[model samples]
Target: MKKRFDIYKEHYKALISLGLPIVIGQIGVIVLGFADTLMIGHHSTAELGAASFVNNVFTLAIIFSTGFSYGLTPIVGAMYGTKLYTFAGQALRNSLVANTLVALLLTVCMGILYWNIENLGQPEELLPLIKPYYLVLLASLVFVMLFNGFKQFTDGITDTKTAMWILLNGNVMNIIGNYILIYGKFGFPELGLLGAGISTLFSRVAMVVVFVIIFLRSIRFRRYKVGFFRLGLSRTVFGRLNGLGWPVAFQMGMETASFSLSAIMIGWLGTIALASHQVMLAISQLTFMMYYGMGAAVAVRVSNFSGQHDTLNVRRSAFAGFHLMVALGVVLSSIVFLLRDYLGGWFTESPEVATTVTSLIFPFLVYQFGDGLQIAFANALRGISDVKLMMLIAFIAYFVISLPTGYFCGFIMDWGVQGVWMAFPFGLTSAGLMLFARFNYMTKNR
Candidate 1:
C-alpha cells in the first residue's frame, strides 16, 4: 500500500512537470480565441455570430489535424524513452507530410462549404455575413496544420514549453492585429468581420514560420538534429504515421463535429439561442482546453512508461490524471453553477440569452465527471497506441448517441438549447465508462 501511494506521488509530480507547460500553452491559444470573440462581439452581434460560424467551420479542420499530428507524441515518447533521437526526428518529418496532406483535403472541403454557406439553413441575413468571412479563415487551414505539426513534434519530445512561447507570441500578435484590422486603427483599413479572419490567418502563418526557424536554427532544438529537412519520405514511415494518425483524427473530428453541428441544431432555435450557444461554447472550451492540457500530459506519461515496459506505472499515471481531472471538473462546474448568470451578462447584454444560458448550467455540471473520465481513458488508450479502437468508441458515443439525443431533447421535446447542453452528460459519460472499461481489460490481460 505504501509503495502504491509512493507511485502515485511520483506520477503526480510527473503530471505537473508535463501538465503545467501544456496548460499555459493551451491558455495562450484559448486567450487568442477569446480576444477574437470579444473584439468581434463589441463590433456587432452579426459580426460576432459570423465570427462564430467561421471559427466553427475552421475548427473542424484544426481539431482533426491536431489529432492527426498527435500520432507523434506516442512515437516520439517511445523514441525519447529509448534515447533514439534520430528516430524521433524521422518520425517528426513523416508527421509533417501526413498532416499537410490532410490540411489540403480539409481546405478543399471548406471551399465547398464556403460556396454553400447559404444552404446551411441559417437565417437569410446571416448567410451573406457568414460566407465571405468563412473563406478568409479557410485560407489559413494550411498554416494551422503546419503549426499543429510543429507543436506535436515538440510535445512528443517533452519540450512542450517551447510551443507555449510560440503560441504566446502569436496570440499577442493576433490581439494587436485584431485591434488594427477590426477597428482600422492607425494606417490599417477597417475590415470588421473580415479583419478578424485575416488577423487569425496572419498570426497562424507567423507562428508556423517561427516554429520552423526555431526547430531548424535555434540552439535549443539544434541538438535534436534528426534530419530536419534532409530526410526522404519512406513508404514505411508514411504507413506507420497513418496507422497512428488517421483513427485519432477521425475520432476527434467526429466529436468536434458533434459540437460544431450542434450549432446547426441551435440555429433551429433562432438567433438568440445560437448566440447563447456560441457564448457557452467559447466559455466551455476554456474548461475543455484545460482538460485537454492534462489529458495530453497523461498520454505523454503513459506512453513514456509503456516504452519502458512499465505497465504498472502506465496505469498509475492514467489514474492520477483521472483523479486530478475529476477534482478540477467538480471545482470548475461549481464555479460555473454559481456564476452562470454573471458570466452571460459579462459576455453579452441580452437578458433572455442570459436566462437561457443559466438554465444549461446543471447539465454542464452533470457532465463534468464524464468529460473527465473520457478524456482520461481516451488519452490513456492513445498513449498505449490503441487509437483505432478508441476512435470506434468515440463514434458510437458522440455521433450515434449524443447528436441525436441532443436533437431530440432540444427540438422535438421543445427544450431548446438547454436540451442540447443536456446531451453532453449522456455522451461524455457513455464514452468515459466504455473507455475506462477497455483500458482496464487491456492492461489486466496484457
Candidate 2:
C-alpha cells in the first residue's frame, strides 16, 4: 500500500503546477458568485429564488457548453506533447468554431426553455425577475463559449497562468459591476437580479475580447497563431472535436442536470427553500471547481503522456490527481461542516434560509469524496479521449439513479430540500468508482 501510494508522490509537483492556476482562477469565479448571490439575496429573497432557478437552469447550459469546449484539451495537448505547435493552433480555431456553434444551439434550446419556464412550475411571483435575467444570461452564452475555446487551447499547451490572470481580472470586473448595478450605486438604476445578469454578460464578453487581443498581439502565441490564421478550419478537425465533444457534453450535462433539475423540486418547496438551494449551490462551487481544476490538470498531463505512449505515467498522473482531489475534498468538507451553521448567513440576512442551509450541509459534505474522485477520473478518461462510455455511465448515475432517488426522498419520503441533496452522494460515488475502474482497466490493457 505504501509503495502504491509512493508511486504517486513523483507526480504531485507537476500536477500542482498545472492545476493550481486553474484552482486559483476557479476560486476567483467562486468569489464572484459569492458576491452576486450575497448582493442579490440581501436585496430580496424573491430575487434570490428567481436567480436560483434561472442560474441552475443556465448552469446546465453553461456546464454543457464547457464540456464541449473540453474536447479541445486532449486534441491540443496531444499536438503540444508531440511538438506539433502549428496543429495545436489549428485545433484552437476549429475549437472556436465548434464552441460557437454549440453556443448557438444552446441559445436556441434555452430560448425554448425560457418560453416555457413559467410552465416549469416555479413560483408565479418571480417570473418578472426570472425573465430578464434569463435573457441577459442567454445573450452571454456565445461569449462564454468563445472564452472557453481560448482557455482550453492555452491550458492544453500548459500555459495555465494566462487563463488564470484573465479570469481573475474578468471576475474583478464582474464583482465591481455586480455591486454598482445591484445596489443602484454609481448612477446605475439598481437592476437587482437583472443587474447581476447584465454584469455577468459584460464580463464574459470582456474575457473573450481580452483573450483575442492577447492571442493576436502576444509574441508568446505567435507560433500557435501561425496555424490559427494559415491552416484555416478543417472538416476533420471539426469532426474530431464534435466526436469528442457531444459525449462529454451529455455526460457533464447529465451530472449538472441532477442539481439543476432538482432546483425545480426545491422550488416546489417554497421561496425560502429555493433561495436556500441557490446559496448551497454557490457554496458547492467552492469545492467542485477546485476539484475540477485538479481534474483538468490530470486530463492535460494524461493526454500529454498518452501522446508519447507512456501509459504508465498516464496512470500515475491520474492517480496522483485523485490523491490531490481527495485531500482537497477532506479539507474543504471539514471546513464547510465546521462552519455550516453560519455559512448561509454570510450570503443573506434571512435566519430561515440560514437554518435551511445548515440542514443541507451534511448532505453536501457527504458527497465531497465521491465528487472529487469522479472529477479526477472523469478527466483522466477525457485525457485519453475515452468519453463515449462515460456518457452512458453518467446517464445511469444522474438520470436513472440520482433523479429518481431525489424524487423518492424529497417527495415520496417528504424530506424536502435535504432529501433532494441526499441523493448526490449515491450518484457521485457510483460514478466515481466506475470511472476509476474504467481508467484502471484501460491503462492496464495499454
Give the number of the best model, judged by lDDT: 2
Instruction: State the lDDT of candidate 2 residue by residue for 186-302, as single tens digits.
Output: 798988999899999999999999999999999999999999999999999999999999999999999999999999999999999999999999999999999989999999999
lDDT of each candidate versus the true structure: 0.82, 0.94
TM-score of 2: 0.99
Model 2 residue pairs with clashes: none
Our tally of clashes for model 2 stands at 0
> For each predicted model, how many residue pairs clash, with residues at least 3 apart or on different chains?
0, 0
Most accurate candidate by TM-score: 2
**Model 2 ranges off by over 4 Å:** 1-6
Worst 10 residues of 2 by lDDT: 2-11
